[model samples]
Target: MASDMESDIALHLKADYFDFFDLSIEKIIGSGSTGDVVLAVHNTYPDINRAVKRFSLKEEDLQKRNISLERVKKLFYHEVEMVRDLDHPNIVRRSNGIVCPGYLAIAMDYCPLGTLVDHLKKMTSERIDKFFPGVVAGVEYLHSLRIVHGDIKLQNIFINADNEAVLGDFGVSFKMPENVQGVKSVGSTMGYFAPEVLKKKPSVDPFKCDSYAVGVVLRCLVKRRRPGYTSDYMEEIRSTKMEDKFRYFLERLLCRDPCKRSTMSEVQRSLIEFTPDRYTLELSRKRCLEDISNSSMPQQKKPTHKRSASSSS
Candidate 1:
């Protein structure tokens, strides 16, 4: 019965979509925004393992206007153009994609290691420091392409099996135009947003927003707590208000003025020269590995939230 169901799904999927990575639908590893499914596929006629993303255009209610179908089409085109144009090792490589009836998907390289958010939640500072360079490099590469990731939270960044950081989730990226009006409410986590975003101030810069998010992630590594939100420690950081080193870094990134924040290039330089405190790296690594191993074993599906169309840029 299971085999029959799998075969049915295979029949529905288009050949052009499946041929790029050379795998069937049954090998799906995960799914993302808008039922975007990622499959662990084989290369060279079952020689090697690769990952592919397929976009499904099934409407919840075909009787309705089917706005979801339109969104899927737009997103598919946007992702293909963006990913094809971008050439960064830290960014997931797009092998190919196909737009077929009820099925549209892209092929990408699979990363066995999971999201950085999950990894960071479990690890200490030391382990994070050792692996932080990859993140910096990835961000630098994005900047080189004149793109602002807009969303730089931990969930969008993944760690590979080799512990290298790979940036993903480019659903809200933007290239700066010379005469651009400011973006209002780009999708971003509350605790991770910069002051400019929170205040909804005009003249906000997209690059600075990315910088603020990076600072938030860095603070998570050093403090083991999400900053900007109202926690006891966060309150303490707020009260100190730029006195503490970590808080200072956060403030610098989260500065209301875009011109004040450090650029991705500067961030890369800092990560390379950084010397972490003793024993922090090993402890963080152990904790992260343990947490991920335990959590990934029995994955529970969470309710999906509707993301706002607003650009964090």
Candidate 2:
């Protein structure tokens, strides 16, 4: 599989890079220090709407950045390469990629509904039941291939045109080498990092780290906000009145010891057998309706500042 993927990437690299002139940029949907995300459509494929992510100046002045753009190129290439091989419905689909002089861009299906976080803010138990299966299936597939998704936050989980949860963003993902306990170090986001990772311990299990993040993601989905990376979050979880099925599952996922944490397969199995409690579903639905009502209200106008007459004179 590895050799086959290498050959495939080679072929893809040789293929014509997407022509920037042919793509019409609609608007800037998101931007950050790493890069900017634009909504664009290819003139040749007008019917297709894509979210194009541009990694600017990633290929310039390698020594200053410490890591060469060659390495950066591999990261994007690896993501594209992995996407090409995996055909699961829950994994975000990649359309095309271009490596121009100063930047690299990859196009993917434009998710109009937004991310999992957006949906979770007004979450319902039905939504969790509906989306959780697909997400677990996607993660299970990655684990089956020994690919550790180093980042597993809600932002990386997108809602597709079908309203299904599709996991995206493989910037921190890596294939685990056989016989290795874990990687020495890796990048992560706050609140999502496992205890071992937070402590900067040697030989941290990347896969287990993913489970820890997923546990946090699930908590956020229930609370409509990311949990603080402190004992307070755990205290809240303990005190919160939740269904036994869910509480039990979360207990396994949120265990402080990575060894005690449930594997992706175990999570998948639990989700299969477990049904969401009715009381929880009702509470979720109530919150969703409240969110709708709040959003429907008109925003009040801000008072305008008046210029002083002295300044005019």
Candidate 3:
């Protein structure tokens, strides 16, 4: 599989004396806790555009923040190694890892259509069905490796050029301990956390927490509303009008009890078994293109702004 992927992908960069000067940085698309994500294209492979997350820090600053520079570097390398090797269509592909002087960066394919959140404004009822399977497949891939995505929410799910959902920002993702009972929760955002996680219980099923989050993400996909607190969002979901079967399935996902909550595999199976209208998939693509076209005209260049993140898009 790796060799096959290599055959298809021409540019496979390594962490070495990669010529930093060769990268033509167009703009800084985003800023995260580690560093800035600059949109760039390498001189050799301009066709392969990338979002480069560059990490640069000083020992003095780390001292002030009471953080260990070595620890930070260790985690950065871990993330690079973890993401760079993974091969999944529903997950963002890591194109390169650079370890040049005063630079530690990971480059991924740039998704021009923006995140799933960007399309929520026009997300029709059936479009969520269109995206759900892909999202489930991505999450399933991570869990199959026993990798727990501690943070899975709106901002983390990026949309590719084909208008498909791909999971990114794996800074907090970790391999689940052999003890299937639970794993210590690491990085997270507030609104999507499950009740057990919100309470900070010592032992909790990480996958359930993620499944609950997936439910929240799918709900937000069409609702175009960011959730508040877990309890509040639960109430909102209860009242929100959706298909009876979907609502029932969501009930399984959002169930407070981790034991009773649906696993991602179960959810995937259910989706595959039931199957939504095939036409809805095409309709979703059509609508996405229409939305992009309508917004593309009268191109207005917006100023780049730095925003803190646990990881890059």
Candidate 4:
């Protein structure tokens, strides 16, 4: 009887593979080292769109890769497991997944407006301010769960259909091998990594590292440009005439010592106490646009926010 039950379970798992085939790809959304994300719709719910991430490994690529397939599989499942357990308004939700020979696909909510990176390129400080609280709230929620989002850059932040900033790519830390004894170089982005990570400290605090990245992300949003390295932008920020409190906030985030950095809770408190209002948001946008128009940086012809479907025109 036990043997028969085990066989039944195995068959059920085998049958699950068919679910991935039901997704019809609309277009390629994004691609990275691990796989490609496609805008797709499930056959059962053709009216609604979903983002399907498919992992495919070719023979030549697999043979030339340094990491083993076993390691990659472990990491991928770790991400799925982590995402499956999270329930937050600001975090992107994963719906389902499927696995087959040499391929794996996971479906998640589709963000139609693209990533914060795309918006930041043209958005002014006012527009960035609108999204700032949502970003911090999302990160604060993650830290509350004791899960560190290894990568938290503008590119990983998506704009939902409701015009809210929703954080995605929140589980890249699973890429690390479970048994690694020393500081493993997971190739975190340069400017976003905390100093301890850069030093390859044996036990770098992932939480602190994430907070540091949030600081960089916040700075990039305000500056409306990529903050390449801490050293590269620290001096520039210091020289710029920003509000004292905001400048101090960014400085504390960029603190080299992890212990000196601000906690997400503390950052949230500061935001609530000193949050900029809509008037300030508009004022800042105007000032920033004037500066850009007078400077050498390429200015957008007209950077306008798209009206949300639910909002009055």
For each of the candidates, the C-alpha root-mean-square deviation to the true structure, in angstroms, is 18.1, 16.9, 16.6, 13.5
TM-score of each: 0.70, 0.75, 0.77, 0.74
Let me know the TM-score candidate 3 reaches against the reference structure.
0.77
What is the per-residue lDDT of model 1 for residues 166-188, given as tens digits with 9 covering 90 to 100?
A: 88777678766656645665546
Best by TM-score: 3
**Is 1 or 4 the stronger prediction by lDDT?**
4
- lDDT (Cα, tens digit) per residue for candidate 3, span 1-313: 2244433333334433235447688888777676678888777887867888876656665665565767656656667656876889889976565655565677789988787777878887677766778888999999898887888988888888888888888887878767666765644788888888767888778877888888888767646777666533556667888776667667888787778889999998888555756457767988899689758855653433123222334
Choose 2 or 4, whichever is better by lDDT: 2
- Cα lDDT of model 4 by residue, 80-121, tens digit: 666776788788975454555666666789999998888877
Residue 266 shift from truth in candidate 2, angstroms:
0.3
Q: Model 4 — TM-score against the truth?
A: 0.74
Off by over 4 Å in 2: 1-21, 43-46, 58-71, 275-313
Q: Quick one: RMSD of model 2? A: 16.9
lDDT of 2 by residue, 1-313 (tens): 2255555553333323345456788788776444677888778888777887776654454554556555766766776665666668888876455555566677778888788878977887778777777777888889888888888888888888898998888777888877776888654688888877777787888888888778887788777786685522556679988766667777877888889998889998787557556557877998999689668856853233123324545
Q: How much is the lDDT of residue 110 in candidate 3? A: 92
| CA-lDDT, candidates in order | 0.63, 0.73, 0.74, 0.70
**Candidate 2 residue pairs in backbone clash:** none
